[model samples]
Target chain A: MNLILAPVRGLGRATLAVVSAVGRGAMLSVDAGRSLRRVDQWGPHLVPQMISIGVASIPLALFIAAFTGIVLAIQASYTFVGTVPLYFVGALVGKTMILELGPALTGLALSGRVGASNASEIATMRVTEQIDALESLAYDPIAYLVVPRVIAGTLMFPVVIALAIAMGIVAGWLTSIALLDLATPQFVRGLRLFFDTYDVQFAMFKSATFGTTVTSVGAFFGYTCTGGARGVGRATTRTVVVSSMIILVLDAFWAATLL
Target chain B: MSIELKDVHKAFGEKRVLRGFTLSVERGETVSVIGGSGQGKSTLLKHVNGLLKPDAGEVWVDGQRIDQLEGEPLYETRRKVGYVFQFAALFDSMTIAENVAMGLRRIPGLSEADIADRVRTALARVDLEGVDEQYPSELSGGMRKRAGLARAIALEPAYLLYDEPTTGLDPVTLSMVDELILRMSDRLGVTSVVITHDMESAYRISDRIVMLHEGRARVAGTPDEIRDSADPVVRAFVEGRADLLEEAS
Candidate 1:
């Protein structure tokens, strides 16, 4: 009876923590929305953040997309050889990159890079009393800090996703020509044959949503951080985990609802 | 402007920090709050600027009820009251000049030239000279404290709140900080509220010293009155005798 009761209590505590976090996150979103109205104040800060989030993230996203596209092309060729035309590999790679892999994988990578950094930086500010200092100075910390990062992330995610898709398609095309013994004309034909403008639009939408989730989650955890150094570390870890999970869940939701 | 806290009650979780605590400070007065660690000294200072609102009671700043205020009204009040944190709390990413200029830029119609001039003047007032481009991390502890003071004073606030300003400083630096506090109060005509455990510094700088214990302002008087207080708790604290408190308890 004691063991059963202890597990139940633990479960209840876990549920409560999760619910509290979600509620807090909703409140933060509303606050951020209101703060966004005064863009003139925070708008200048957004460019630097965008450069940090979008430009700095490009190398890693491209690197991952390159390898992912190459692997997908190779695997598709292996699976479709003799059973179907090899040109199908191009269609497969292109479709997957635009419709799913481009946004999802880039979002996951950035969840670790940008999300973790945002959380740690903001958490450090909180622990060091910089946030309170800002408040004491009559500066709205949400407007000064959180809103800029959120706007940058929302704007840059689609750009990063687009770059990743381009890199992935190019890498996949090169891999097909080098290893799969496929003619460039046939591969290009396959890509053009199945192309739909809606897939690109869908990917753009998903990237923007994922970007918002990754940044806002990090900002929320960091802004509300307590305890000190250990708490900052926890917030960073939670930002990565929660952002990645949310990106994947969002990926599924978009695919199911839109596709 | 003057400050007042009436029957203020504050608690974090089950631990009550301030219990029906009340105090008042006249404009242009320097009051030092001294207490043992975690005795709500900092919490009380925060209440003056509406940084930390009380769970129950009213906080009046210059006859305005500030505890109930929010948004621009609250920020307007905060803009007039400058808070100096224990560790200076400067933005590490920015230079000392940028940090000092931050609050000045918030003033409407202040041009770039005006902000720069105020930053220089504020830095000079704190005896910090020509280290504008250096970051907070590059400055010594004393310099950082001075820079933090400069940042707070650049706005030319009506009230200044100091939270343990002399805690980590050496004896010389501590005296220097105390002197700076006195000079700022006199020159700027800003009301000052200092929270510290340094009894000697408190006695030297404050017009009145408030001693907090057991979640209340147990002793409130001039330095001489506090020194001669008959209350055991006040006696134990002023004399720095933990044994007396233990024995009394």
Candidate 2:
């Protein structure tokens, strides 16, 4: 009976902890929303963040997408065997890259790259008393630090994902021609066979949401972290893991609801 | 125009701090709060600036209950107080000049020219004249502290709060920081509340020294009074004697 109660209590505690975290995250987002009204204060930090969080993330995003496209095209061929039309490789690669892999993979990649950095940077400031300094100096930490990153991530994520998706398709096209017997025209035909503008819209929308989740999750954990360097390391790790999990969840949600 | 905290209580999880703490620094007065590592010295200072709200009491500044203030009103109240953190806490990325200008830039009508001028003047006041282009990382610990002071003064806050401003400094630099604090109060006519573990600096710069023990002001008086205090805790801290702490406890 004690063992049973212990496990039950553990489960309840974990549930409460998760719920508490969600509530905290929501409050942070609400605070960021309020900071929006003081645009003059937070606005100056936005462009630099876009450059840092978005523009700097491109090579990594495109690199992951390109490799994914190659593996995807090859996998489609291997899975379907010779029984299916070879052009289906193009369809598989195009659809999967545009609709699923592109944003999801890029978001995952950035969850590690952008998300971890964001958490560590802010967490370092937290431990160093810079956040307190910001507060005492009459600057809103949420507005001056967190909001710009969130806005940058949300606005530039789609742009980065869009580029990655295109890169993936091109890589897949090249892979089909060189590796598989499928010609350019055949691959193009397959790509065009089922291309829907709605697919692009869905990917963009999903990527935008992923952006917000990644940055906000990173910022939230950073703000809440304590201890010292060890705390910063924990926040960085949490940012990556939580952002990746949320990205996958959002991916599934978008696919189920939109498609 | 005084900064006051009345019966303030604060705690983190299981560790209760600042229970029933009370103190007030009149306008233009310089008070130094000294204590052991976790005796709520910093916590008490944070209350005065509205950085940490008290759980059971009130913090007042300029006739406003600052602990109850939020948003723009809180910001408005905070703008009048300048806090120099323990670690300097300068923005890591910005140059010293930009850091000094940060709070000034937030003001509505300050032109770029005026902001730049204030930055220059603030830096000069702190004796950090030629390191404007350098980052906080590039500066020595003492310089970074001065830069932090410069940043605080750039806003021309009526009240200045210093948290361990002379910590981790050599004797020369410590004396320099002590002098800087005195100069800020004299030059700007700003009331100051400084938290420090250093007894000498406190004795030199503070008109009054308050010893915080177990989350409350255990001893409050002039430096000479604090030195000659009959309280064992105060004697332990003022005389730097760990043996006297046994008697205190």
Residue B16 of model 1 has an lDDT of 96
After TM-score superposition, the amount by which residue A13's alpha carbon in candidate 1 deviates from its true location, in angstroms, is 1.0
Residues A156-244, candidate 1: write the lDDT tens digits.
99999999999999999999999999989988987887999999999999999998999999999999999999999999999999999
Candidate 2: tens digits of C-alpha lDDT, residues B1-249: 488889999998899998899898888899999999988888888899898988899999988999999999999988899999888999998899988888887677999999999999988877789999999999999899989989998898889999999998888777877887898788877899999998888999998998899998888999999888899888887788999999767
Q: Interface RMSD for every prediction, one decimal?
A: 0.7, 0.8
Report lDDT per candidate.
0.91, 0.90
| DockQ of every candidate | 0.84, 0.83
* Candidate 1 C-alpha lDDT tens digits along B121-186: 999988788899999999998889889988998898999999988887888878988988898788
User: Where does candidate 2 stray beyond 4 Å?
Assistant: A1-12
Model 2, span A26-144: residue lDDT tens: 89889999988878777998999999999999999999989999999899888877698888888888999989899889999999999999999999999999899888878899998
Q: What is the TM-score of chain B in candidate 2?
A: 0.97
Worst 10 residues of 1 chain B by lDDT: B100-109
| Per-residue lDDT value at A215 in model 2 | 94
TM-score of each: 0.98, 0.97
